[model samples]
Target chain A: MGRIYKKPVSMTKIAMRYCPGCGHSIAHRLIAEVIDELDIRERAVGIAPVGCSVFLDEYMDCDMIQVPHGRGCASATGMKRVRPDLIVFSYQGDGDLAAIGTAETIHAATRSENFTVIFINNAIYGMTGGQQAPTTMPGQKTTTNPYGREVKVHGYPIKVCEMLSALDGPIYLERVAVNNVPNVLKAKRAIKKAFQIQLDGLGFTLVEILSPCPTGWGVIPKKACEYVDEKMSKYYPLGVYKDLTKKK
Target chain B: MKNMEKYKMGEKVLMKGNEALAEGAVRAGCRFFAGYPITPQNEIPEYLSWRIFEVGGTFIQSESEIAAINMIFGVAACGVRGMTSSSGCGISLKQEGISYIASAELPFFYANIIRGGPGLGNIAPAQSDYFQATRGGGHGDYRVIVLAPNSVTEMGNFPKLAYDLADKYRNPCMVLADGLLGQMMEPMEFNFDWVDPDKLPPKDYIVTGCKGRPRRIINTLHMIPSILEKHNWHLYEKYQRIEENEVRFEGCNLEDAEIVIVAYGTSARISTEAVIKGRKKGIKVGLFRPITLWPFPKKAINELADRVKKLLVVEMNMGQMVEDVEIAVSGKSAIHFLGRPGGSLPTGDEVLDKVEEILSKPASPERERGK
Candidate 1:
């Protein structure tokens, strides 16, 4: 009998601290699998953000650094610039990436910094107790937006993929979701390609994963997945917004 | 190596203060620099923009001061000597990032060529950032090693000292200067030998890769209150060690002097001349310039307080370091302040005038301790 799927060698045996049914587990597993398949685990450097994914250093069995809130890309830029040989990526949440770190994200892309960013957009601030995020859906009710997000009051969701696609510095930009098995597979592919682009010395590749937050969304595990597929996917369309590898 | 070919060992070259420090950093094996432009310190990044590439080093004109400091934080994590620079308003923006660097105990160096400021004050030189620089300039209970250099030669040389102390303690070190020291042109030789970064020893704490060892995680987050408290204690111990072992200052004419002028950085330079002039006039004055501002030369000042009748603190601010001097003296010596805040630099004549006026007064009996 052939060997079936097993836990990735790139991941440590420590138990994850992510909330049950949170998409961080899936994204972590996918990233670990990608790192293992690419055989760059030894030379991989991960920058963990301050959101719920702050414990990314615990799960990923690679040399990692935890940066201040929302400065992941800036730190990643420093790491990758100094040690261009190492594979560097910043694991950031929606608030970490788009809200407080908006300047870092935009400037890193504009400079075409040679690193990968795994952006998990759960539409709400997870570690901070379900507060509104930059990607929070309009009419969505969060801890800060109990009456539901009004476009006039709370502002529209920041379409990161679309916004970054307008910049010429990025070599690849893709949006994927981990709501179902097929979508999970696509998300993994996009992540692997983003890393591969970085390995090729391509500049500033990012994959925005529309991850689910069952606890934050006040929904069961299944309903969170259903909400991502039914409602979240409509607001954040899934596809490649920019791919330099693809010619017109 | 290629970029530094022009600079000979022990050769005194005429250069601008900011540019000399930039070159000195490259000589000190600083292979990475990320800085944003601000007045008085812009020349550092501007010079390194071309100079760093000559030696195959990385230089980044960061999008903001916050980004620059965070980038250096990353480089330091990689076990490389990285640095950043800015003036007052910009350093204000960098406080949060500096806090993170200190909390993580990352070894990095930075410079603050301070301009006048309570807000975006002015581009002129000022020592107003004394409180901000010595008091951690950021959140949390942390202290960065602060070196106040008065001369352009010290500006060129202090980067090596900052790097040495930073690496020794795994703490951030700051070379605190002002616009006058940063922009003035002077001839000075670098104090340290040329350091090829590749020749430096590898750091165990650095996060290069887990090639043959367990993975390394450099982090500052301690979620549990007790654990965080323990981390703070650990940091406090390191700070105590630094205070014990690394306090540096310069004392001139202290023997038999009746009064002492306490100052650092630009004010120290001015007071040096004032002390010399006051001596020619038989005023019996001395200068005590603190080289390390945080682990401030408290012992020397306290002892001097026992001998001197008064301690006159000259600063380009509204009497900030005077409080520290008072704390060090503990009411043993009467204290007087001469301030020229908001970028108006005090001349030697002005400081000398203040020194004579304080000396002319009868010794205050209230602050006098029983001999």
Candidate 2:
């Protein structure tokens, strides 16, 4: 059959391993499509942290090193400093970045390491049986937070883009969503722009993408997208939190 | 603005053991160092701050021990020598990354200035982490090439040896020394020039932009169970080669000795004095020092097992290396252990007293030689 549009070459031939309609597949495709378009697949080096995204090695074609819990950003920092020729990036989740890896994320950004960070914030720990993540909604119930999350006990959800925007080191910081066709298009552009900033040899750049996690949310795939739009978006508003490139 | 530090090339220079380790890395073609400040190993990063940069390498004082090890992982994955160092507790924090490095089979050299521990233990010298160092500190079926250096000279010398052994097996190598060794100063000479990057072979697995080659993925996440098993076996086979080819030890007066002291690191240095004192007292005693602690000098110990009547194992820990000595002796000789953990060191006279006590005990006649 003549090809009208085929899968991105940056993604491997292996079948997708995420749950049906999970936003990970779409996000992975967005990144792969960006790498292919930029023509940097040969020089791209990605670090996969210990989470559901650990399976990224199976899909991402460029050089990769799967690190332990919460060390993706630190690993990418090391790779980028030593091999500035390679385009380095780290793909992380809410639990990996906001909680377990908070030190690495903040330090890497404060150091202004020239790499891209694609943070997928689904408001819950999708791997390891749906535990409460640092980004879990105030009233959201999870395995660890069996009862609906209470404000006094569970604390508030972390707005990563908002928190990181306070820092002066990062050159670009934006929050996007992949809840619908319009949002998906914005998310893809945000991901591509973050990578472009790195290609320009600028400082730290990150895109926080609010995506749907159907199995973790205990909802059908279609409803999960609506939930991301209606619920998650209310607390984690989508916008460009910081844009040093425009200021420059 | 050149700093006050200056030394003539190839001339003997007085250096601290930890600083010697840093200098050794520069001479060994190490290009990256990512470390956090710990008690005894603080000077390593301090020395490397200018040394690595002066040699046209990179140095990153990571936010924490966990971050430093992961940074080393990145440097190693990109195909160059990288290192991180800490004390016992900081090393405990680094176990997860160490496991990943071992599983991924990246080559690098790290130095551990053994300090007292169980928690945020004291800053004094202690070897209580022998099990953690030798038996694969991380969670996996893997062993690092462990080199236990006794003097500041060994500190200046072991980095090249450790890095070479690491690249030989594509495994992490550890330069195991105690806080005393790190604190002491000694004059030493280097075998090669310090700024020569062309000395060692270029990394074959380095992912330097992957020019005409297929994009490479240096990963350790094997989803399939059988695939992981195969990787483990591949590592095991490599370890076997290491065990066979790299067993190293130092023995003094073994042929005529009735009692042999088995030790390594700082304890071994003291034990050598004990051997000397015992020999002066007309007691038949000797020292068997293990230079390589992981693929332990078992072959030599097994051979010496036939000669010695009893082996007195001395250490600055609560008897960590005794277990390996026991394994090597294989019930061929009686093994006696004397240790002082928690930052206390057994003196040479104290070890001599223990040697005398063991020497006074009549040799059991029924002990079969080489059972």
Candidate 3:
């Protein structure tokens, strides 16, 4: 068979450790392509969160630091403060960023630390055996909440991008999905723009990507994308919440 | 007159302890001050903000203690001297950042004006943070250099000393003072020469990295257990070196003294007055003041163990320094404690009466005869 296309230079040659058909690899490749296109690979520092992607340090060619669970924002804050000349970004899973690291995320945004945050919302905790997360939809069943997530008991799913967009410190805030090829392309553009905002000295930019976790969501790889479109999109509603560069 | 003038360091200035500390930080070339206002130590950040701006420095009133500490972390990572000041509860909030700074081996100064605590206990002066400051407040096996300044003059000089010691050792150093010293006004001399931050030796370990050269990663991650253990061992060795070279103490008539008063900070100030009162009554009592609480002056007090019949440790808290005194005395002499908690400062008369009671005791002939 003839080769279909060349591998993106930004993507690592090594085999990925993520589950088969997982959206992480796609998201990772897209971010890598953006970094390659922008020519920021050398000066870019990636902060790996304490989740399934904790070993992101090994995959990326650039320098990376693994932050404690719920402390990716704090570590990125420290790094950006130390090296304001460099382009810094953090990649965090929903469980890590939305739950344990909620305080750090809010405070970092409030302080408007000049860094980009690539937040992945998979609705469920992937690494910890499909546990319920802060972004888990109402009435969603998980290992922790087997019966179902009752809003009265567990609270409604948090809309992080919408919440953070209200803060003046954040220069850009957008939510996108990886459920389809077209949406995946849009998410890549948002991610690149988020990093570009920091490069321009604009403060606190975040791009929330609605990703699919096939194994955690208890569905086949293709069906996982369908579930994200049918259920997750209804709740998350992907779009730009705040774009300071845009005019009315 | 010209020859005598050549021997002098600088002129004396009567300044409040907090103001003196701010001036000392500036003199030490500290250009970044980020802190939130708290009781007893408000003057520290207040003075530094205006003065630092006047000296072409940066001063920020961060939204919270967490922001203030992280700001310091950022500036320190740039290889510049940065500082933050807070009282008890505020210090508790800064512990996580302190741990990271310690593990990163970044040199910065933190002034913790201790107040009564276990939780928002009181804004009043207390040495309750002794265990937290000297024994590592955060979650880690790290030790920070703790300088306990007794008087306002020492408060002025301690910041400069703290900056030097932090850079020399590449570790966090704290100026641990209480509310009494933080609030008190006293005559201080800024005689020490300042070290310009811009002129200091370049730090190769800073996170700035080799711009066009090798890619350097600054992190505290050690996947290998043995490497982490080795790093911890090296830190312990540094602590040992600091203990030997940095331990400071002031001995007042310790030779042939019957009773020795062991104290530090404001408690030491009250102990000095008590020693004078005891001497006026013809009691052979002396004072042993610990200037540096950590890398504590154990050796000096141990040497005085044989000379003094009794050692009395007076403190604001209940018997915090008494343990150190006992460890120093090692059964050589009777170690006693006189402390007041909850913002109470023991007066000279109270300490003097205790000294008389200890001296007037009959029974042991040698102890009585020595008095």
Q: How do the residues A92-134 of candidate 2 rate in per-residue lDDT, one tens digit apiece?
A: 9999999999999999998989999999999889888899999
**Candidate that scores best on DockQ:** 1
Q: How would you encode candidate 1's per-residue C-alpha lDDT over B309-365 as one tens digit per residue? A: 788888898888888988899888888888989998999999999888778897673
For each candidate, what TM-score against the reference?
A: 0.98, 0.95, 0.88
> How well does candidate 1 match the true structure, expressed as C-alpha RMSD?
2.3
Which has the greatest TM-score?
1
Output the better candidate (2/3) by lDDT: 2
lDDT by candidate, in order shown: 0.91, 0.87, 0.81
By summed lDDT, the worst window of 10 consecutive residues in model 3 chain B runs over B362-371
The parts of candidate 1 lying over 4 Å away from their true place are: B1-3, B365-371
Compute the DockQ of candidate 1. Answer: 0.89
The alpha-carbon deviation from the true structure for residue B215 of candidate 3, after best TM-score superposition, in angstroms, is 3.2
Off by over 4 Å in 2: A1-4, B1-10, B193-195, B364-371
Which of 1 and 2 is the better model by lDDT?
1
Please give the RMSD of candidate 2 to the true structure.
3.2
TM-score of chain A of 3: 0.95
